[model samples]
Target: METARSQQQTAPGAFLAFARFALCGGGVGIASSFAITALAAWMPWSLANAAITVVSTLLATELHARFTFGAGGRATRSQHAQSAGSAAAAYAVTCLAMLLLHQLVATPGAVLEQIVYLSASALAGVARFAVLRLVVFARNHAQTQKPQNPQQPPRRHAVAGAAQGGLISRSESVEVTLAS
Candidate 1:
């Protein structure tokens, strides 16, 4: 059916959107990791990581709206808030992983710490993608896109017949139909 074909086409578009989102998210994570590493030299590791996470999350949120979700200038305030919430979730995951890693290896070297951070970020990326695609942008995209099939107004049909006094009697009925 036409509906099935249209849905098949939409599936590919959704996949492509997810692919773009992952790529952009990965790039942002890498950049943020580098910034965090640099900042760690001057500040406490946790403080540096937190500061970079906030800035990078804001930047990534905007980038995701513009490029990943193709929302561009049309992204709503609520959508942006959702994006920020997703980032916060990812950040929490990363931080927790870092805490666990530090617990296991009490005094990890700088390189080891960076490795742990990047690994945690990669895991968090998957969560971020799911939240962004399924929660933040899904409904908005569906609402903005036109429906595959639209319902047409009901049609009226009339029939006329001769009456006893040479007057015409008319009967009318409504027919409902769907547009392809």
Candidate 2:
């Protein structure tokens, strides 16, 4: 029964995590696409795309680390590296898709190129989310099972004073009773 209840609770938590990932990923994608398109107007398409990918990936990594994966600001160096690696994998997929699309249509228009980029980015976002959840920020079972900050002092309780000699002050007595 406890296991079933825990699973039920975790299901909502998992969905919330996925929702955060998607929200952050979508924001990054839109910003990256705009930057890429603008750069492409002034520079070579491939160069602009690559530059934007790196910048956006870094932004997305930080966002995912803090918001999506609940890593707070304590992500380890290895985790950061893994996040970057996942970004690279996603970038590779987008680049490959772009290449394939270019091959299919010679001299594709700017609008068509943008369309392909957005499509590829959407697909890569899905892949990136999976990698981020499963590999980059994978939670260890032991860590989850263990209490955090075990070395820290336990919380003080007013009842502890009353237990000693009923010597607690009026405020402490009220606190203890309220706590009970």
Candidate 3:
């Protein structure tokens, strides 16, 4: 059977998913920036950034599962773990870019720093999208489907016709079963 999830994995579906991903992830990223700035006023800068990243990642993963990839419900623990892995990579990417900029330039202006960070983050975000689509949330999603009661077997109805010297029997209906 062609499931809605399978349909969403197609070309148009991928486009829609990418759009939703941009909206959700971008929104979270923007919010995280402001949140980190505000929180930094009260706590250590590093601690504030870490706190915002954790909260933003949780929000983004949930949005991706439900709205971006159309996963039909909340994210699973496995999905959260995978998303965190990708987010960590993205964090490392941005951090490394800044470190490189500082080492190469004696004094880089705030504008240059923002450009480098945003560029690195954009690259990482693209990679994260692919990982989320093809790795983290790639499943049949059949669990959402209801199953027929195995205890009550399907009743078969048939007809028997006369043959040359015996009986010819055939089922009027066909029963098909699929595994996995």
Candidate 4:
């Protein structure tokens, strides 16, 4: 029999999960792009993008968990902390990848930098979804119980009427019946 979890691990669910992540990230990306573009007028593009990504990631995580994943309740501190840590790690990866792309494809007076950054960030969002689904979201700490180990055995005890001397003289054998 297939369990719910097993079913959810299938390709359809994986696609759905990726779609959800993309939608969430798309919403965040739009906001972040706007902010970064505005800020880039006065600051370096990388710095502006970095700041916007952080803010956008926080917003995206919250909205994604609630709307996409059907998460309930006000996020607990631990949950927020976990998401924040995940977002930071994901953001760092995204920024680094974007920077690499910028260095590779960039030229003076070219407007392709932002496009490259967006693509790289989208790829990073895909990576982030994979990690979050497999690592963070899959682990339901509250519901799952750890399996018991099977290798440990109980201590042996002497059977009743077992003689330590092991002497077998003529003796009457009695048959005992057990009732179920």
Candidate 5:
């Protein structure tokens, strides 16, 4: 059963998680903005955006899995793929925002373009945070954070579980054990 303290922890925990997500993902987005611009000097804008998006998504997902979501380890391939979907959405939003900016103000100033792009990126980041926390890393975080049943005998696993079990299961196992 859930205790009062555990319940309280949920709200703050989520807030902290979002904070971390913003830090890691936002940092990557900011850097990628510059990267995409630099690459555009050598290639088409769309290709630059595509390349930067792919790289940033990979980097951000790993940071999120390890530090932001408290997944306790590296990200899985499945998580990376799900994260890419959200990243694609973000890329679309940024592209559309820039496109609209150009439509309204032909030959927009660089500052104006940056503002519009970053604003759109911020909006998409919020949605991406939800998707990442609740979807991409949900199972990983849940598996890491399960409370132990003190009354029951300790759980064992055939995979690479934690070296010791106390009141909880800290196993990093990806394998599911069936009860006989």
Candidate 6:
């Protein structure tokens, strides 16, 4: 039942979903890059980048959980928890990959190193979108098939003893006048 047309109409199925994640990720990346660069100025570059990755991943997970997938009512505390877990794993992977790439290429210059780190982080962002969209915020498609009950008002009953009163007792059977 998921046609291309339907998919196009849905926010998740649209490319904007990825773009939305990317935009939020970009803000996280900027904060990360600034932190990394500042730390690198005083300490080892690798350590700085690693620290930034850890911190930024946490921030990005919460932002994405609140903003990106929230349109479909998929933003829940459990989803944020899952995103945080995934971001932690992804952070480690991203840091290791960037560090390895930098060591292998022998690029110690700040600018070049940052460029490489950003590229690696960009790849990690793609992985994040995949995991978050497919696993974390994924809605159950099967639940939509069940029949739904229409809204109805509750029934009122008249009590024998309360015939003069406005209220009726629950223990007694009462005549309920039908309203036109």
Question: For each candidate, what TM-score against the reference?
Answer: 0.69, 0.69, 0.67, 0.61, 0.74, 0.61
Tens-digit lDDT string for candidate 5 (19-86): 99889989998998888778878998678888989999999999998888766578999999999999
The candidate scoring highest on lDDT is 5
Ranked by TM-score, the better of candidates 3 and 4 is 3
TM value for model 6:
0.61
Q: Write the per-residue lDDT of candidate 3 for residues 1-180, one digit (tens) a residue.
A: 333334444423678888988899988887776676578579965577567778888999999988888776799998999999998888888678877998999988766865776778779889999999888877524332322455544433232333322544343332222333
Can you write out model 1's per-residue Cα lDDT over 51-115, one digit (the tens) per residue? 98888877777777777876544567788788778777777877898889889997898788778
For model 3 the TM-score comes to 0.67
Candidate lDDT scores, in order, read 0.70, 0.70, 0.72, 0.59, 0.77, 0.64
Which residue pairs come into collision in candidate 2? none
Tens-place lDDT per residue, model 4, 1-180, is: 222233333323566767777787787886776787789889987788678866886677676566544443244455566766766776676568666766776553334656765776777777777766665555432222122233433222332353334532224232221111
Please identify model 6 stretches exceeding 4 Å from their true place.
1-11, 43-47, 71-75, 105-107, 139-180
Q: What digit string (tens of lDDT, one per residue) describes model 6 on residues 47-68?
A: 7766776677667766775667
Model 1, runs deviating above 4 Å: 1-12, 145-180
Clashing pairs in 5: none
Give candidate 4's error at residue 90 in angstroms: 3.2
Q: For candidate 1, what is the total of clashing residue pairs?
A: 0
Pairwise TM-score winner, candidates 2 and 6: 2
Clashing pairs counted in every model: 0, 0, 0, 0, 0, 0
- Per-residue accuracy of model 2 over 1-180 as CA lDDT, tens digit each: 112223323432557878998899898898888898899889977788789877887777778777777664556777777877877777787788789988999888877877888898888888878887877766532244333566643233445544467555546522111111
Show where candidate 3 strays beyond 4 Å: 1-12, 38-47, 140-180
* Structural RMSD, model 5: 7.5
Residue 67, model 4: Cα distance from true site in angstroms: 1.9
